[model samples]
Target: MDIGTSVITPSESAEDTLPSMFWGLDPIYGVFAKLYIKDILELKKSQPVPGVFFYKTHPITKVDILGTIVQKRERERFFSFGVDDGTGVISCLWWKKQRAMENVRLASSPFGLNVLEQLNRINQLENSNSQLELGDVVQVRGRLRDYRDQREINSTSVSKVVDPVFTAQIARMLELPYLYRNFYDKTFQIQMDSSDPNQQGEPTLSLQRKIKQFLTQNGVKNFYQQELEAIDSLVCIAEQNCVSLCLHHPSQTSQDPPSSACVSKQIHELFQQAVCALQEEGIIFQKVAAHTELYLVTDAEKELHKVTRKIVQDDSTRPKYVDKGCPFHHIVSCVRHSYSAGVSEAAVQRVLDRLECDSEIVSTMDRHYTVS
Candidate 1:
């Protein structure tokens, strides 16, 4: 056997020495073996020694491919090139010197790069192949060289080549706007320069509030337009309280007492006090369902009969009406049955205790009632 091909054996150590970091610094043999565009920026201060860069080529493999093109020109070219393996993609370029290699010439025509090109024939090849439809995946091997003129490192030359299977599904991933949002991971962000705190030029609190309110109103309107259609039935519309309540008769929807006296009398006696309690705490009762025709039927009807009958019967003390339905109603119903039997003061504690009851009826009750 040739001396060079003789049995492999460990040689005696002549001197202890650290292995060259060159392999560790190899572009294809990254220490971590994978990185993001932002992560590569961290290595700016300590870049690996210049050498060949071999990676799968795709749009995302190259950092700022489109941005670089856009910055150079007003718009990006039809295609952007990238290179990577399962590990990660690195942006690449082909310089004039490195592109002269014979291997670089082969990839030119298949990729539609012109052979007569003067700059880098290899670049022409890569560019020709780089015009991939959205989801095509490819593997490329090349050199990572520093462009002294450009003050940046980029891949050069052309070596191994493998075209990944192309699929239309990859087109979705090419959505530029969506990718930008994901890359930033923020719905919206803004920057403001600091100004002198003592300066009279600062915006006032009232001005800020007005601006915020305007923004909020517009945002709410836009949000409603997008989402309201799906929930129109569940949604209730209202204008500022300019409308009068018209209570509908429970037994007969067509006919309502013209006086509005009976309804008002019962409702006032029952819920007036409780309603006042809620109002004192700053809970504003707003009208619900600006144009709803159906109104609620309160227990005031029963309570009134009992009270008036007791008065005639000479009962000494009038027992308060506590056993009644919960005092919530559709606006129309509340107005129609204006007289409601509210929880009596004597039985207020019991009523409060039962408030926690999870009756399905009460749970589904109209949320449009006026609260005390």
Candidate 2:
């Protein structure tokens, strides 16, 4: 059956009203050789709504897949690659100029050296129909499409896999049936009631409360968005709080948890939603630095801490006077006078250590300092 005819473009009503099942990250189904792709191709396509389509089996549109690029072919307007994940090989194509520019931008970033190298390799490859060389592992996120009786992916992103072992581990976890079974079970469901007065007034209040409680209870006054979104980090926090995550079959409960791929996806979605809800309510706030979101609690104490930290960090980088060098006490005094919060000597010392480690400051004789 033709799968393209059954594809659903999300409606405006669905986009605006449909509550996300989990918070921080939107759910993207995983695909490998043995799973959904093979089954989806075998199903009969049926259009259920004006823009949406279904099949005999559930239709999965957006997906995350990993494979090694065995062949690459570039045309005048598009680039295509064949990705094989042992179980199956799929064709992936990137068609838009904007997408190409985004790839370039990502490659230009400081942490994108590997990406740059990959791009360079692509450039160096001869017109022998290779944009990427054979055996280059990659992770793809895209919409699945079928054209002329062939299944292919219209890629949104195609990233070079920096850590193949870690990617393999994730792929293995996603292949487990128990993950999907647990996900469908009611035990993992987020409680939401349309009938309750509080829920009616503010539908996301309970979710916000849970997120706030999780942050506060964990003593996470400040954290990077990635740190909070990381599966291992979240699992560590959950373990510390004696919270149980239902990521496995109901019958087989174990203290040593399985890979957190499934649990992380759910938690990430919930965390994302809760953070957005809290931000909208002005309960918490985020600041972007070095292209990463840093969340901070919006309380007086935490606000003061932020100010103090900034003051010390800033002072450490400032050029020292020629006549009198910048000393540790000088930083404390400046911070104390700059803000009513009264910066402590310990805070200044801590900042010094951080700056020194970062190579932003150099310590001289007699406890004096100069910016490096």
Candidate 3:
């Protein structure tokens, strides 16, 4: 069944294919394809899906990118940075959870805490960010959006990278070529059974779609990539259920469900692919801005968003938040108290970043946020 060894299946004629078919059912559509900014800027818009861009045969709706902030302009709601990835430069818009204007408004009363306390708080908050300075590197994972005839990254989450040795940026730089040559540029071997995704389609695609639907519908707050105990362990749950069904009901084989036919490693990789795909679409996130393991449903995490927002809203520029907005540590403590002890600082941080990116919360400083 794994006959797809080449880019284009020779049997398929040109007349049999359409661009939308590539956009609709291909697994690449779900991926936030990693490509050079030059390629991204050069890719023509997909005729079938106006929002999507095409890199040769690849259909790209989103991207997971790393670039340097070569130029920047801070706006009321977002920060506009000109990001250069060596290949090209593109405008990257990172919307804030807290605005600079709000900071000016909240910090109106400059005579509050001792100078040391203020400095300490500022340092503590700023420890999480490199002050988003020019020349500093940032990782932007979001959709490819064009505004005013200019291509830009409408980032879902933007975080400053602490790569003193440039390890992460370098690794991505080395990895992209292999991915492009082997995966992105290659044409998929079409399934002759059903070209349309709407009709009964590939089981793996089906499962991914189902999980995405589940996250979207339930507004699932959080999940784990490897932890089985996680409440919203989509990958783990599917794997457990599938393997269990195979053992319990010997008659129920993987052929009936292509997703189950693979080995444990394959299933894990596939599910992880699903998770990554969801990440590309902004349906699920990798984790907190500072942390990297927990995965969250983007549409989900609402209640947590509310909890973090309230901490800033009720106490902005007050004693707990001082005039600077709620400090990161205070916000963490509040989240643990209001949400659940089970939530970690990383998770809270993720929630804060999520809320901020959505403009549900605002932070004028590095780690502090004032809810708007």
Q: Pick the candidate with the highest TM-score.
A: 3
lDDT of 1 at 288: 29
Error of 2 at 222 (Å): 36
Which digits, one per residue and each the tens of the lDDT, describe model 2 over residues 1-372?
A: 111112223332222222332221222223322234444344333333221212222334555667788878878878888887665778889773523424456525666467766766665542223346778877777766677767777887777766745645354444434334423121211234433333221323444565567677776677665665564644454432222333233433586564566455545555565567666554555443222556665542444445545654566566554422465566667656764333335445555565667776666534455656
Candidate 3: which stretches are off by over 4 Å? 1-16, 19-22, 98-130, 194-372
* Model 2: number of backbone collisions: 9
RMSD of 2: 20.4
Instruction: State every prediction's TM-score relative to the real structure.
Output: 0.19, 0.32, 0.42
User: lDDT ranking from best to worst?
Assistant: 3, 2, 1
Give per-residue lDDT, candidate 3, residue 296.
65
If candidate 1 were superposed on the true structure by all CA atoms, what would the RMSD be? 32.5
Query: Judged by lDDT against the true structure, how good is candidate 1?
Result: 0.29
lDDT of 1 by residue, 1-372 (tens): 111111211231111111223223223243222233333332322123233222221011123222111111111422224443323444545343234445543445786766556446546766665444333443333323335422232433233323243222222223333444333222221122233331121222222233234334444312221132233221111100001112222342445433445444433322333223332221212122111221111111234323322322232122321222233222223232433333222222222223324221222121211111
lDDT of 3 by residue, 1-372 (tens): 222223444244322344465456667779778888888898777554568876655567888878888998877777788888998998887775542432342333476646555655665664455357889888888898778888888888777888897768756865786688668767665544222332222435645786777666766677776542233555555565445434434354655653345446555655665565556555665434322377766456777778778877887858745555776777778777887655555557767777888887887665667876
List per-candidate RMSD values in Å. 32.5, 20.4, 18.2
Best by lDDT: 3
Give the 10-residue window scoring lowest on summed lDDT in candidate 3.
193-202
